[model samples]
Every structure is written in C-alpha cells, then in structure tokens.
Target: MSEQNVIASLLDDLTQMQSLKTALCIGQDIAQYDLNKKIQWQYFNASDILNLPFTQRYDLGFVVFNDDLNRRSQLERGQIIVKLRDLWAKHVVVIAPQGDDAFMRSLGLTRIVDDALQDSQQTLWQFNILSYKNTPDWLNSKFWANPENWNKFRW
Candidate 1:
C-alpha cells in the first residue's frame, strides 16, 4: 500500500493492455517496468508537460503527483490534465493524493479505484478519450475543445 507499490500495480495494469504501444510518463520515471518490449515508454519532468511536442501522440499517459514534489496550483494542474487529454489517443491515468478528487473531476477524469489500498494515500483516475467523445455535452464547452486554443496547446 506504499507509494511504490501503488505505482507498481498501476504499471502492471497498464503493461497488460495489448493496444498500448507507447506511453508518456509525466512527473516520474517509470522505465524500470518495461514489461512489454514492444511498448515505447518515455519519461519527462512535470514542468515539461505543456511543452511536449504534438506531432506524435501516445496511446497512454501517466501523470504522477506527489504532494511535496508537485506544487503547481489547481488551475495549473487542470491545464496539464487538459493538455494531456488532448495528446493521448486512448487514455490518461492520473495518480495523486486523495485530496485532488474535486480538481480531477473538474478536468474530466474519473476516479476508477474500487477499493482503497491498505496504507496508501494516493488515488488513481482515468480519462478515456474515446468515452469522452461519446458522452453528451461533456466536450462541447470544455476549454480544450476550442479550435482557437489548439495553437496554444501545442508545445
């Protein structure tokens, strides 16, 4: 139920997805669990989240937020999530401490954790782009959907 264990479990789940060919990990390095030789995994600093290139999109993105390390404001964090959602083809997984539920919800991420990890303080959230596309009224007014903002979204 420790932070490392929680991350390992999430990595295990992500690696099991056959459709996941590439992944971008923001805020932490997750290359040690290269379970799939075919999967291309890249790590980047949290600050680079907005500056990443847009030419190539990843199948999945992992964003980890530690209280002591990620001190960005709520609005800044929301922007990061929005940008990641736009760049990811399938899904974006956000791992943060429990207090971020409201902020995560505002960014369109759904908390998918069914049970709490015994001694863990982190929570897992998922934003499935495909599902978001199908949902009614969810994407129409979101800040990221505006065509004019697309240019600014590019790094």
Candidate 2:
C-alpha cells in the first residue's frame, strides 16, 4: 500500500476519527487526509511559515516529513509534536521517516509504536504528543483559599 494510505489507515485505528472536529494540516501532502467531512481543516505547505502562527486552534494537528528540496526544513514548517500542540491544537500527530527517536522526543512527541506500518516498506514513523490533562486542584475555585472563607475553612 502507498505510504499515505498506510498512515491514514493507522490514524483511523489510533484515534476516534469521528470525534475530531478540527485540524491544522502542516504539509501540502499530509493535507490530503481532509477526505473526512467531519473536520474543518486549515491547510498549509512546508515553506509557508509566516501565516502559521495566526491559524485558529484545532483539536489536532498533522505533519508528514518529506525530503522535498524546496521544503523549508521539514521540521520547521508552516507548522512539532509542530511544536504545534499547545499552540495550534491540543494534540498533534506526525508521519516521518524512521531514525530520529531522540530528536523527536526532544520536541515533546512520542512514537506510537516501533513498527508503525508493518507491511509497508517505506518505514514511516508515527508520533504523537502524549499529554496529560492538568486540571490543578489548587487552581480550582472550590479548593482555593478565598478571602471570605479564610477563618472558616480548615486545611
């Protein structure tokens, strides 16, 4: 199967495809997954960097690293993990060529598996930002030391 197809199929299995409401597609090629009518996709090519910072936030983001010579550093695109999560989306997914575990981890994304596409010969590596929701209890009003309850409330 083609590399794109393999990535798309794997995405179907890993995520609740129907639950995704919006996405920021960082590469022209990766943007092809827009076949899903459920998502409001904002597309951009690798070389276009200036407009990326202004893009609306999305539920997720996608990028496919390519060796295209014209691309402005595949890792520094119109979009890491786009360095995208926490900026453009709550989560991010990537499809890149194999062999950059340490480098990618430095960017805050983790591999989904060792062999992302077992049958495909292309050897694409899939990565995602494994994030934990931080709803800090101390930050919540119910747990806060409100001035009105200063004497009445006990630790």
Candidate 3:
C-alpha cells in the first residue's frame, strides 16, 4: 500500500477506536443511572418522555441521573435542555416518542423515530433540546451555545 493509504488506514482505526470508547462510556453512564433507580434499564422514548408538564419534566431530569459510584457530580437538571439542543442540532438523535402518536401530532411535533436501539435512541433524544434539523459546524461556537439560538432552527 502507498504511504497515504497506510496513513488513511491508521486514521480509520483510530476513529473506530474512539467511537468504541465513546459508546462504552455512554453505556456505562446509562447503567449507572439505571442502577441508582433500581431499574435494569432506564431509557425511555423521546415522545413518551417529553412534552411533559413542568413537574413531570423535573422528575424526568432527576430520573436520568447517573448515580454510579464513579459519578461524583450531581445531575444538572437546568442544563438538560441545552444538552438536548446540542444532540438534536447534531442529528445524532431524533425526538420521536413510543406512545400517543395523536397527542404528538396534535401538538404539531413530529414523532421520534423508533428504529434504533432503545438505549441508543434515548441517548440521542436525551441530548436533543432544540428543534434544529441541521448539524452545522457553527454549533460548536460559543455564539450558538446560547439557548436563544436553540429556537433559531426548528425542524
């Protein structure tokens, strides 16, 4: 193989390794959260979990907490929306719910796609706070970090 091909192969391997690590870390995080709740699996669909009343929303935030021994920080309920926005902006997750299709339609919200693994799907929605459809590089910039910009691009 040419030198360039060798370099490309190495890069691909590194990328896969990084993705594997991320998947592992995210999995561990979910396990820890579920353990805290005394549940085997704690992930729920975006639809079943969102559009909740204020009180219910707060409860949902608390339940997502990863209270594992390795988790020293408390769950940041206030920051959940911002995190979700980032996820949605990245197209890494959608906001589909698993129940009450008509309710979502009534509210004019698109149902979340349910084809992905439950845990994987939840991870995407858990981080999706904005309605933005495109994942732009500018999402990483500080200006776009503002919660106001979250509404700038709704799906």
Candidate 4:
C-alpha cells in the first residue's frame, strides 16, 4: 500500500485501542484517512507550539514532524512532546522518521510501528503515549493473581 495509506491505517488501529472522544492532528492531514466516527478529529499547526496555551482539552494529540512542516531539532522535539503530554492532551502519539530508537523510549514512549510502503523509504516510527494508572486491573476483576486459579478466584 502507499505510505499515506499505511500511516492512515495505523492511525485507525490506534483509535480501536480505546474510545477517543477527540483527537488533534498536528502538522498532518487526516481528511484522506478514514477514522472512527466516535472521535472528533481536529487538524491545525502552530508557528510556535511551545508558547501555545495548555488546555488539555483533547483526548489524543499527534505530533507529526516533517521537513515541510513541524521541523525542529531533537531537543525542541522533546520539549514539544512533553508539552503535549502534560498540557495539550491526555494521550499523545508521535509520528516521525526512523531515527534513534532510544530517543522516544527515553521520553517514556513505546515504539508501536515500523513499516515500509510504496515510493518512499517505507520506514516509519510510531511511539505510544504515556499510560496513566487510574485503577488496578486486579482490584475488581474476578481473577486470581496466580495462573493456577485464574479461572476460579477473585482478588
């Protein structure tokens, strides 16, 4: 499939993980991509993202770094990621070229995608957002902590 199509598919997959009430697509186009209707998607660019106000209004925020748009040094990129995670959205997804794998990991994000597509290097890197812990899975679930009694016990 085409690179754009592949990226679009990846985005679709992410929405399935959880019901996102809203998503903000920064420096990328989502109109061509079919996403979950349950999600309200907004696309925009800021000349100065660092100085933008912190509203934490969106459920998810995407920071797509491209040469034509949203170009910045690694340090700047790190700062933007922090800003987005802390103030702009509850969850953040970063889409960028394959660079140092450790960079995103160091920032507490997990790499979720690496694929090649038509007419381009086909190599892309996707990082997951920080997962905040609101509850423990075992607290109310009817399952045991040990596998021997997983089917018959509750914590």
Q: Which candidate leads the pack in lDDT?
A: 1
Which residue pairs collide in model 2, if any? Answer: 80-83
Give the least accurate 10-residue stretch of model 3, judged by summed lDDT: 19-28
lDDT (tens digit, per residue) of candidate 2 on 1-155: 46666656655654564367777766544545444556666766554534445546777677666554224554554234444655666667766555555656556666676354555433443333344334667778776657998888678
Q: What does the lDDT read for residue 32 in candidate 3? A: 42
Candidate 3's residue-wise lDDT over 63-154, tens digit each? 22233311422133222333333231221222332332453343333443433335432312322224434677776767445776786777
Tell me how many clashing residue pairs each candidate has.
Answer: 0, 1, 9, 2
- lDDT against the true structure, each candidate: 0.74, 0.57, 0.31, 0.65
Q: How well is each residue in 70-133 modelled by candidate 4, as lDDT tens digits?
A: 4566787777777777777777777665654577777767665454442454234443344544
RMSD of 4: 7.2
Candidate with best TM-score: 1
Candidate 4 wrongly placed segments (more than 4 Å): 46-48, 68-70, 117-155
Which ten residues in a row are the worst by lDDT in model 1? 113-122
RMSD for all candidates, in order, please.
10.3, 4.8, 16.4, 7.2
Candidate 3 residue 2 Cα shift, in angstroms, is: 39
* lDDT score at residue 99, model 1, on the 0-100 scale: 81
What does the lDDT read for residue 145 in candidate 4? 51
By lDDT: ranked, best first: 1, 4, 2, 3
